[model samples]
Structure formats: C-alpha cells, structure tokens
Target: MKRFIKSRGGMTGFVLLAFLILIGLAGPLLVPFRDAGRHWHDIEYWQDSPAAVPPVWVRGPWNAGKLARSGRLQGKDPVLFESEGGGGRAVWRFMLSKEAKPMRLDLILVIGGEGKRPVLVSSVGDDGAETEVARRLFEVSVGQPARLALSLDGARALTVTEYLLPGETARDSPSIVLVGQVSGLLGTDVSKRDIFTGIVLGLRWALLLGVAVSFLTVMTGIVLGISAACWGGWVDTALNRIYEFFALMPILPFLIVLSAVYKPSLWAFAGLALLFFWTKAFKPVYSMALQIREEGYIEAGKSIGAGKMRRAFVYVLPALLPYGFAVMALSVPGIIMYEAGISMLGLGDGTVVTWGQMLHDALVQGAVINRLWWWILPPGLMIALTGITFALLGRGFERVWSPDRGSRPTGAGPSRSGT
Candidate 1:
C-alpha cells in the first residue's frame, strides 16, 4: 500500500478504482437523491426532460443581452429559459447598481427538448402587472432552443417572464435547460434517459463481468490443466487439442452469434467467456503442473499410494496458484473489454446498462453530432480508468514476486538490482 501510494499514477488509479468498486457494491445508493428503482431500462417511463440534454450546471456563457435572475454574464450565449407547469410565467429579474446609458438588448426565446410550444413573452412592472413587450407566437423545435427577438431599452430594474399560451401542459420535460434535483446531474441521454444513473448501475455490471469472468476462467483452467497434465497420455492429448482448436476460432463472431441465438444476460456472456478465456491460463498452469510432477514431494506422495485427485489438486495446484493469480490479474482487462465491446456493438442485453451499452446508445442517438459531449465522454473515461487501476495492481504484485526484487522495504533502495 505504501509503495503504491508512492507512485502517483498507481495511487490515482487505486483511488478511482476503489470508488468504482464501492459504486458496484452499493448500487445506486451512491447517488442518494436519485430514484433507485428507475434505471436506463426505466428511462422511457420517467423521461421528464427532452432527450440529449447537456449538463445543467455547464452551459455556455450568458451574455449581456440575456435576462439575468442572478450571476455573472460573459460572451453572448443562451440564458436558462424555463416555464412552470401549465406553462406559467417565469420571471428573470435584473438589477442596476448605478445609472446606466440606455442600450438596445435582444432577448431571443429558445425552445428545446419537447417541441414547438407557443410562449407568451412580456415585461413586468413593479406592481406585478404584465406589460405587452413582446407577445408574438413563435414555433420551436424539439431539443432546440430558439429565442424570439425582444429588444428592451436599458432600465434600472427589469423583469422579464415567459408564459405558455393556453395549451396542454407538456407531459414530457422541456427539451433544453433541464438541470435540477429531479433531472440527473450529468443530464439525460437522447431518449431523455438519465446518464448519471446509467453510469452508476453500469459499474455493477462492469465489476461483475470482470471479476466473475477472471476468477471462473482461472479456476476452470487450473482444474482442467492440472488434471490433464497429471493424468498424461490420452487425457493430455485430448485436452491440448481442444485448447488449440478454441485458440483458432473467431471469438467475436461466435459471441455475436451466441447473443443473437440465446437470451442475453450477464451470466450467459460469462458462461460463454469460460470457453475461450480458460485456455490463456491453461497453458501456463499445465507447464507448472508438469514441472511440479517431477518434485520429490509428488513422488513421495505417489510412493505412499496417494490418489491422483489428492496429488494433482491438493499438492500440485497450490504450487501453481501464484502464477495462476498473475495470469488471472492480467486476464481481467480482456474480459472487461470483450463484454464492453459486445455491449457497444448492440450485441448486449438491452435491459442491462454497461459502459459499452451507454456508448452504443450515444452513438445511435447521434450525441456526437449534436455536441452533447457529456453523454459520450464519461463512460469512455471510466473504462480507461478501470483498466489503469487493474494494471497498476497487477504490476505491483508482479514486482512483489520478481526474483531480483529486494525486500529492503518500499521506496528504500537506490539500486534494487544489487540487493
């Protein structure tokens, strides 16, 4: 732990990976404010906002022309445009600290998320009576925010509000400017699916697939490899042929076909991976087992009439465990990549929310073209981070087991090679 922390990359990776592991174990509880039961699958029911909403907190700079409730304004950009249920009036209050020259300002009404909803824009006086400033009806597109030109002269105090012309209260959320408690922090997908929650839940699937596949594949390899090498003759020859045959098969196509044929689930993919992944661990385990066969302890056990099971598993397996563990650690990334690849390719179970599935949805939804960057970036970053974490852990262990590695203590030796 000390040595790992001493290495900056390793420490960063460890912290990130640890958080993700906790996310997997705790499920959606990490984001306590979010609805735990509502996931990517349940997105359709609770998609209150328009699809492909950008993060609420991170909008472009609101310029001088945009009405201000409160906050600094920068380069010309859209201010948050929102209306209450029944398309009620939304007031944006602006204050003037000093006498200012009158300047013409254009306030464009950008409608987004759901579709064209006629908005009634008007200025308000101190008495709370609505003034007919700009009461023109304009059609707006879904997921596109368009502003109507409302040029207002400079004033000490200005109250600008929008009202929805009497119409059906939009059941679906407004397409743009959705950033609040009910909406997710990271915003919604193209389907108005909560990307934050999807990411949270996807952690579970990622950790499950990675660890389950690695441990199972390694364990299965150990059993088969040791058994074949110990029994020798026909058993060894047959198992070797099977291993070589699988090595030559097209894994991606096979998995794609498998997903197409069977009901896709986490366990189903895990089981399928068992066929291919074990061989990677199998060869090394068998080599170690064969080497162990010549040891005096094994011969002594045989001379004492020890059973093959006891000799192969009880004695020989334990000796190969360290090497087996290294192989297992190295193999984790491949399993994760495979699962993610399949998920990205649309070969994943629709109900399941994995990192790859998120990417798949984003691509299909044209998130990149729309510049909804939040949807595309996070999952890819997370996948890379997870891989880095495991790689650090695997390398740390490999150093621990290296023959020339000194035991002087972590961060101790100037020249570890000599020691």
Candidate 2:
C-alpha cells in the first residue's frame, strides 16, 4: 500500500478506480444534490453535437463579423454548425461571472414569407434549417420570458430566456443566449434518475453475478483438477485428456450448438464458461497436485494409515492450495476477457446487463463510433478497471502467501543461533 501510494501512476489509477466504483455504486443516491449526472449527459451532448465543443476562449479570437468573413462558419465545420446543414450556423459566447462564462449560438429560423415572426432565433446550423411552430400573436413583448412549443414533432420544447443579453466569453465554453434570460445552453432530456440509476443498478447486478459465477466455476475446476492430479494413472490420464479436448474445441461452434438446443440465459453462458474455464485451470492444478502427492507429507500421511480422501484433503490439498490460487489468480483476467469476447459475439443472453453485454449494445447501437463518449467510455472503462482490480488484488494476495514475500522482520534473514 505504501509503495502503491508513492508511485504516482499507481496512486492515480487506484484513486480514480476507487472513486469510479464508489460513483457507480452510490451515484443514484448522491445525484439529486451534486447534479453530476447532468454534467455527464451535458458533456456527452456537447461533445456529440459539435464533436468537441471548446470553451469560450478556446474558440480563438473571432469577432461576430469574423464568423461571417471566415466563410468557414457554415455547416462545413462541425465546431460552428448545430447540425448537418449547408448554410452557416450562428454561435455566441457569453459570460456568467468575471471569471465564469458560457457560450451561445443563434439558429436562424425562416417563418412563412408573410412578414410573420421568425421561426427560430436560437442557434443556427450550416443547413439553414431551424425548428418552427405555429405562433399565436395574442400579445407581443420583446423582453419577456415565455414558454413556446415548436411545431416539429418530437422536438424538445425550448424556453426562451435571456434572449437580449450579449454572449460573453471567459476560459470556459460557450453558452446559449435566449431572448430574455441567461440560462444554460439547450440540453438533453437526461435526468439524474435516467442515466445513473439504471446504470448503477445494472452494473451492480452484472458484476455481482459475474464474480459469483467466476468463483464457483473456478473452485469447482480446482477440485476436479486436484482429483485428476492426485489419482493419477487411469483417472488422471483419462480426465485430464478429456478436459484438454474440450478446451481445444471451438467456443463459438459450441455456443451456437448449445444456444440452439436450449434457451439462452445468463446461467447458460456462465455454465458454458465454467465448462471451458474449468478446463483451463485443470492442467496447472493437476501439475501442482501431482507434485504435492509425491511430497514427504503425503507419504507420512500414508504411513500413518490416513484414508485416501482424508489424506488428500488434509495434506495434499493444503499443499496444493498456494499453487492453485496462484494459477487461479492469473487466469481471472483471461476469464473475464474471454467472457466479454463471447458476449460481444452475441452468444450470451441479450437481457443480461454484463459489461460484455454493454459493449455489445454499444456496438449494436452505433454508439461506439457515433461519438457518444459517455455511452461507450463508461462501459469500456468499467471493463478495464474490473480486470485491473482483480489482477492487482490477486497478485497482492499471491505475494502475501508466497514463502519469500510479504513482510520481512528487521534482521530476520538466515538466523545462526544453533552455531
């Protein structure tokens, strides 16, 4: 732990991972007040629509007139355009404080050519397309905040706020200036309950089930492996070879064959993984068991008239435990990777919300390449962190159990008291 804290990268990674897991676990609870969930979705939308929305100052030095002069302002450049269009989009930069600022953009809307009011006066894109709806001219006020509905079906309604304020700029990104109020830029419908609660609940179930299945399957393999190794001759030879044969068989073909015969479920995938994963642990554990069975302790147990099962369990299995755990530790990351790969291939249960399934969904939804950073990044990061955590924890435990590792007392090396 001390070494990890001292190492910058290790400390950083560990801290980041700890916080990420905590957030994944407790996000739904803390979301109402902290409002990080809004930030997550807002960041996602900001990045997605313009690819990467720069802060107000990051827009570089450009006057309002310069945007029109540049001829680069049209839908040709994503930074300036609200959406994919042929014409230029109007953008604005606004300040929230002396140091804090928001960026804004004006989207031009063309109302019917009856000298009527403009359809859209918000942010305009290069395509010259703006959302428009029928307006009732019961009252006309220039600087009043009002709720208006756009005629475009499914289009999110916009609140016209701060429409008259000039956009300002600081180090932060742009903000949208409404007609009367200085509110935030238009955002998505993502609520605190929407993104986090589902994700948190989904991930908790997935990871918990994943760990349980892995532990059970791996432990079962260890037991079978030990049996194969200790009871050599026919028992060892036949079973080990049989397991090896199964391990060598193609997984995809097997999944197809198996899923075809029965309905797909999380259990089915876990079972399939166990079948193959157990095979992987067999060889190493069998080797350890073979070695352990020949040790002096086993012979002593035999000389003392210990029964086969008793001697094996008390003496041989205990000796093999260290090696068994070491091998198991190393195989965990591989197991997770393999499971994810199989899930990605669509062999696993579609309803199960494992990290693997998440990746598969991202791919299917086109979010992987769609620049929806939050959607893809969160799942990918989760998979990576989970693998790393298991690997590091396993390594730490292995070293702790190692004869030559763990703590060494001061001046404790090689005592010569007998001399």
Candidate 3:
C-alpha cells in the first residue's frame, strides 16, 4: 500500500479515479436544477399584464424617424428570451453594415401583450429556430435594453438578445426566458428541482452494474482457470486449447451478429465480454499451477497420504492466490473498457446508464451540435477513471509480487522454486 502511494503514476490515477467516483456517487444530491424534460403546466407566472401596452410610433432614440416614413412602430417585441445567464442575449447573428448602401438597422419587433400573444419567427441562418419572444405587455420602445422572454415550443423556452442601439447594451446580453408556472422553467418548481440528481442517479446505476459484472466474470474465470491448471495432462491440454481458441477468435463479428439479433442488455454485453476475455487469465494460472505442482511440498503432501484433491488444493491453490489476484486486477480494466466500447457502439442495455452510453447519446442526440457540455463530458471522464483505477491496482500488485523486484510469498520459494 505504501509502495502504491509512493508511485507517482499510481497515486495520480488513484486520486483521479476516487474523485470521479465520488462525483458520480454524490452529484445527484447536489444538482441545482430540475428535469430538463419537464416543461409547461404553469404559464401565469411569466404572463404580462394588460395595462402596460406600448403605444405606436415608438422608435429607438437613435433611429426614431428612420422608419417613420414607412410606418410608425406599433410595439416592441416582448423580451422573447432573456439570456440563460441573465440580461439581453443574442443567439442569432446579423451584421449591421457600415457600407454606404445601408444606413441604420430598424428592428420591427412584436411583443406579447396582456391578452394578445405574438407569433415567434426565428431568424434565418446561424440563430436557432425563430421563436415567440414573450413580454409582460404589448409595448414598443426603441432605445431601452430590457429583458426578453422566449416562448419556446410547447413548454420549453430560451432567451436571446435583440439590440437596436450599439451603445445601449454590450454585444453580450443575458438570455433569460420568462420562467413562469412552466414545469421546467424557472417559475415552475418542477423545472428548478435539480439536474444533477438525475445524472447522479444514472451514475450510480452504471457503477453498480459495472462492478457487479466485472466481479462475476473475474471470479468465474479464476475458478475455472485454477481447475484447469491444477489438473494437468489431458484435462489441462483440452481446457488450454479451448481457451486459446476463444482468445484468438474475432469478437467484432460475433458482437455485431449478436447485437443484431437482440437488444443489448447489460448482462448480455457483460456475458459477451467475459466470453472473449475470461481465458486471458487461463495461461497465467496454468503456468502458476505447473510451477507449484512441481514443488517439493506438493510431492511431500502426496507422500504424506493426502488425497489427490486435497494435495492439489491444500498445497497448490493457496500458493496461486497472490498471482491470481494480480492477474484479476489487471484484467478488470480491460473488461470495463470492453463494456464501454460495446455501449459506445449503441449495443448497451437501454436500462443501464454507462459512460459509454452517455457519449453515445452525445453523438446520436446531437449534444455536440447543441454544445451541451454537461451531457457528454462527465460520463466520459467517469469511464476513463474507473479503468485507470484497476490498471493502477494491477501495476502496484505487480511491483509488489514480481520475482525480479519484490519478495515472493512465504513458503512459495521452495514449492514454486523448481518451476
């Protein structure tokens, strides 16, 4: 243990892994927001009252008469969306040209008034879908930079920026939506419940499944490998060849075939990974058993009238424990990575939440395109860290057990000294 901590790489990997696991475990409780899916249900909180309606002929203080000849401004567009961060926000980009051909840009805005709702139109190109900008009243103003509420489709909403005058507000404004009684918006308690909760819950499920699967596979493999190794000759040869054949077989084609036949459940993927890699420890165990079997104590046990089973197990099995554990520690990372790869390819169980699945969603659901950083980064880091932990544990064990490096287990010298 001291050696493990003293090793820089091992310590670093262990710390990173621990931090990631803790975040995955506790993140749900700390989430500040609610379900991103829950929306609609309450609208009154963000609605505008009727009295503050805007009068016609309003224009920006700078371009009051710019559009006067064409028509008088009837009303300003309701703050369609306030930036999520706060203040006026702009998602759609439009350049105001300084060229002689165009003078000043006058925005014809329609805002929602008390009793009257305006139709939202997203600007073409670069900006998101044209959406209804919500305001407290039907009003028009040219010079002031005020908050705009976005009336998103159904119950969802977003806020962006609309600037008529350059100096009135900076190019960056807070995009805020009128969080009303909507289930997922700020006004709705449901909307504000907590996003991290769900994510943490998801991570919990993932870790549970991952650990359970890995433990089962390794334990089973250890038992089978030990059995094959201790009982050499025909028994060992047959088992060794079988394991070797499986190890050599191409797994991709088989994975594709199986995934095509049925939905990839967590157990199914775990089973597949075990099928491919369980035998990895077979060769190591077989070698250990052969060495231990040639030990004087093993022969001595037989000479002392111990039963065949007792001699094989009592003398040889205990000697293999340290080596078996070391192999297991090494294999754990590979198993986890295999599961993650399968999930990333969209062959994971629908019910299980894994880092790979998260990344798959990021890709398939266009989280990248939407720039949803939270959706993709956390899960990825979790998977990576889990793998690192097992790898570090394996390396540490190796350093403590290597014949050329660390001391051998007591009594192992004579029993395993010959072979």
Candidate 4:
C-alpha cells in the first residue's frame, strides 16, 4: 500500500479513481434532475428546458451578451385569481433584460378534476400588448393530475418576439418557467435533457459494469489456469487449446454481430465480455502455477497426502492473488472500452444512460455539426479518464509485484529455508 502511494502515477490514478467513485455515489443527490435517467428520452419531461443551450457558466464576446439565464416560478409563487365561472386563473410575471431576451419560455400547468379544462397561456409585455401563446382545452380525469406544457418555440416564437420586446417585463398566465439560452451545470442536449445529470448518473453504471466484468473474468481465468496446472497432460492441453482459440478470436466484430442480432442488455454485455476476457489472465496464471508447482512446498504437501484440489486451492491460489489483483485492475479498462464501443455503435440498451450512449446520441443528433460542444465532450472525457485511472493502477501493481523488483509473498519461498 505504501509503495503504491509513493509512485506518482499510481497516486494520481488512485486520486482520480476515488473522485470518480465519489461522483458515482453522490452525484444523483446533488443534481437537480434526480429523475434524469428515467426521463432522459421523454420530450415532455424536458420541455421546460431550452434545446441545445450551452452551460450557465459559459460567457464570452463571441455570444454577444445574448445568452439569457433560466428562472422558474412554481408552487405558491404564482398568484391565483378566482374567476366568476367557478374556475381559477394564475399569473406569473418576470422581467427580461434588454441585453438578453429569453430564447424559450415554458408554462407548466398541473391541475385535477374531471372534464375538459380550458388552459389559456398568454404573454403580456410592459406596453400592455398581450399575445395568446397557447389556448388548449385539455381532458382531465379525477384523481389523476393533468399537466400542460406551453412553449415559446415553433409556432409561438414569432408571437412571443412581436409581443414581448426586449427590456420589458413579461407576464405569463398559469406559471412562467423561463428556459433560457444558457442552462444547468453542463447545459442541454438536442433533446433538452440535462447533460450534467445524465453524465453523473452514467458514472455509476460505467463503474459497476467495468468492475463487475473485470472481477469475474480474472477469477474465471485464475480457477481454470490453476486447475490445468494441478492436473497436467490432457487437462492442461485442452485448456491451452481453449485459451488459444479465444485469444485469437476477433472479439469486437463478434460482439457487434451478436449485439446486433440479440440486442442484449448491459448485464448480457458483461457476460459476453467475460467469455472472451478470461483468456487474458489464463496464460500468465498458468505459467505462475507451473512455477509454484515445482516449488519445495508443493512437493512436501504431496508427500503429506494433501490432495491435488486441496494443494491447488490452499497453496497455489493464495500465491497468485496479488498478481490476480493487478491483472484485474488492468482488465477493467478493456472491459469498459468494449462496452463503450458497442454502445457507441448504437447497439447498447436505449433504456439506460451511459457514457457511450451519450456519444452515440451526439453522433446521431448531429451535435458536432451543430457545434454543441457540451454534449460531445463530457462523456468522451469521462471514458478517457476512467481508462487512464485503471491503467495507472495496473502499472503500479505490476511494479510492486514484479519478481525482479519486489518481494514475494510470505510462505511462497522453498519450504527448506528456515527464514
């Protein structure tokens, strides 16, 4: 542990990995869009946000001070006025600066009771000029809340612009949820989904997938490799053949084809990865087992009537554990990349949010062409950072366990030695 921390690369990787894990654990609680994973693809859920907006922190001369910040009026803030017709009307008023008029405005109306309810949404400017943005009679059912989302985009854009001039205070009936040109921590995607929340939620899935797959693959290899060494001749030869076949197999293309055919879920991808990746740890573990078999302790154990299974498990497996830990760490990055690659090709589970899926969305949505940097960059950077973190930790483990540079595990030495 001390040695690993002393190595600069290892320490850096540890810190980075720790930070990512922290985000994976704590991000959902911190982010405002707690339901982002569930409603990421739901257009109605994200209708309150401006589409393809940059982050709130982004500001420069290139944008010409036209970027408007988002604001919301909800709950008890909107004043409700009871009409003579046994219905109530609510109004929310907010000021828009002359320097930046909101690119988009949304009114969310939640109401209950049966029959059709007439929802009138209007934009009133300082000059008392009023423009009806939306007039819809929505069907409502008792015990079920009906929500109406009225937006300034599309047909109402011209009406809003002509009626609500810049620098004027505007009033919206029902409630005004102003979605501006700049929004959230990492802005909005083409679908207007909060990018930061999506990224944060994705971190948990990525880590879970990578760690689970790597551990399974390495453990499978260790068991098989040790078994082959314990019972040599036919057993060893057969396992060798199997390992060779898998090692030479074109995994990526095979996975792509399989994914295309089956449309497997994330867990299914992990299972498939394990089938191919076990071969990675096999050769090294087999060689190590062979060396450990020739050691004096093994000969002594055999002489004492200790069975092959007992000796293999009790003696050999323990010695290989440190090496296995290193191999497991190294294998994680590959597994993550494999999953990400499959996801990037649009073969991933659409129901779930992942870094690769984000990239795939960006490609399909023409984010690059539209110059939506926030959408493309965050997920890509996360994948790269995760890869680097595991790679560095793997190298550090190697340095600490290498035969030439590092000490061997206690009790692994020749049994004849007194020390």
Q: Per-residue lDDT for 304-344 in model 3, tens only?
A: 88875785666766776666666766676666666667777
TM-score of each prediction:
0.67, 0.55, 0.57, 0.81
Supply candidate 4's per-residue lDDT for 275: 93
What are the runs in model 2 whose C-alpha is more than 4 Å off? Answer: 1-199, 260-262, 401-419
Greater TM-score among 2 and 3 belongs to 3
**RMSD (CA, angstroms), candidate 2:** 13.4
Candidate 1 has an lDDT of: 0.65
Alpha-carbon deviation at 334 in model 2, angstroms: 3.1
| Top candidate when judged by TM-score against the true structure | 4
Candidate whose lDDT is highest = 4
The models' CA-based lDDT, in order, is 0.65, 0.48, 0.51, 0.77
Between candidates 1 and 4, the one scoring higher on TM-score is: 4
Per-residue lDDT over 56-142 for candidate 1, one digit per residue giving the tens place of the 0 to 100 score: 555334422332221222122223444454435444444322223433333333444455444445554444555556554445565
Q: Which consecutive 10 residues in model 4 have the weakest lDDT in total?
A: 154-163
Model 2, poorest ten-residue lDDT window?
68-77
TM-score of structure candidate 2: 0.55
TM-score of 1: 0.67
lDDT tens readout by residue for model 4, 140-242: 6765556666555322221211122233232322334566778888998999898899889888998999998899999999999999999999999999999
Q: Give the candidate order by descending lDDT.
A: 4, 1, 3, 2
